[model samples]
Target: MIVIVDYGLGNLGSIKNMLRKIGYSSMVSSNPDEISKASKLILPGVGAFDTGMRHLTDSGLLDILGYKALAEKIPVLGICLGAQLMTRSSEEGCLSGLGWFEAETLKFQFDGIAGKWPLPNIGWRDVFDVNGSPLLSGFNSTPRFYFVHSYFLKPLEQDIVSMNVSYGFEYACGLSKGNLHCVQFHPEKSHKFGMQLLRNFSELT
Candidate 1:
């Protein structure tokens, strides 16, 4: 069963409901045993980076998650704030992420460029699948997904990065390497397109 980590920092109910709608009923758990035995790990979040990280650590879920990803190498997925935590670190509140993916999170700069676009990048935006992983099967190379954040992440290396989405400038939108996959968009909130992506991940090899 898929285990949704609940650190009191994510849109947990909406994600759970979305999964049920897609016919993938998951067990939202913070128990150590449940997480270790989980078929898939979904690290979802919807809050400040530092606050989320603190909650994870205080709850003892962070270490368990790290062990699962780094040692067991279980197929894992991260969304938005969760995806940002997958990177080495983030600039938001000087946050230290889970450091699973080889990327770094940075705040918006490009003043001239961002002036033309919106901050927090809320609502629907299309994503260009650069690596074409099966986790996004049945989804187009450029499909609309939901996003809401101020910072953006770039893969430390291009080889490990896959998709890119444009805001003020194009940045890594999805990241995948081996058994680890991360997306910046919220599939649970992306409607049909998002549903397909979540379904793809549920049955991905």
Candidate 2:
């Protein structure tokens, strides 16, 4: 069964509801045993980077999840803050990340594009599946996904980027490499497009 890591952050209910809609069974748990046995895993978070990392560490899930996703090579998907945590570190916090990806989470700087957009990029935005990954299967047309974040991931390896979205400037919003996959947008709130992505992930070996 697919397991949703519950380390005291994220909209666990919404993720579980979305999976149920796609006819997939998922359980939300912080139990290391359950997490270790998961056929697939979803790491969902909605909070500060340091806080999320601390919760995972305090709950003893940091090591367990690291082992399952990295060592065991289990297919894992991280949403939003969870996605950021997959990187090496974040400007939002000093604590190190899970380091699953050679990337870093950075706060969006208005810089030259000031007044063009607002911080914490909220609402629907278009995302282009540059690589046409299996995780983004069935997106025949330009798909829009809901995003609400002040920070975005900067992956050192551009090849791992599966999708890109334009805010003040273009940024990597989706990443896939081996057993690791992540999305900065909320697929659970992206309607039909999001549903299809979730279904696609469920079908992955």
Candidate 3:
């Protein structure tokens, strides 16, 4: 079963509904034991990164995830702000992240560009594969996925980036380091491509 982390941060209902529609068994809970038992763990988030960490820390899930990720080596997938939280830190606020992936969340400097691409990059856009992650199996190099975020995680190694998308500039749209994987786009919100992506995640060992 897949466990969707619910820390009062993201759209828990939408995510649960999508999973059920796909005929996948999943549970949304803050209980550490239940979360640890999840065959695949999905960290989905919305809103601010710092607030999300506050909720995770408040619910005592930070330590649980940290231990499970490094020790057990369970497959953990993070989406959007959830993905950003997997990094060591962010420029948004004070709270440190779960630090599952060796990366950092940073605001776009729009290198040489006159203006920023736009905050909260919402809507459907193409994402191309970089690291050839199993989560993107059968999808072409550039497949569309729903996106809605401001900041993006910059992983240390090129292999950590699974997909790349262009806004004002190209940034790491998908990332996977070890058992920790993350996507800047919203697979649940994405249309046909989104559904298949979720299915691929369930197939991960």
For TM-score, the strongest prediction is 2
Candidates 1 and 3 compared: the better one by lDDT is 1
Cα deviation at 82, candidate 2, in Å, is 0.2
Regions of candidate 2 where Cα sits further than 4 Å from its true position: none
* Over 4 Å off, model 1: none
For every model shown, what is its TM-score relative to the native structure?
0.94, 0.97, 0.93
Q: What CA RMSD would candidate 3 show?
A: 1.6
Best by lDDT, which number?
2
lDDT per residue for candidate 2 within 33-145, as digits (tens), equals 99988999999999999999999889988888988898898899999999999999999999999999999999998787766777789999988886767787787788889
lDDT by residue for model 3 over 1-205, one digit each (tens)?
Answer: 7899988877777777887888787889999989878778889998888898888888988777877778888888898889998888999988888877778999867768866567767788888778577778876556798888778878887768888888888889888877878998888888678777888888787
Name the lDDT of candidate 1. Answer: 0.84
lDDT measured at residue 38 in model 1 versus the true structure, 0 to 100: 88
Considering summed lDDT, which 10 consecutive residues are worst modelled in model 3?
111-120
lDDT, candidate 3, at 88: 87
State each model's CA lDDT, in order. 0.84, 0.92, 0.83
Compute the lDDT of residue 111 as modeled in candidate 2: 81
- Give each model's clash number: 0, 0, 0
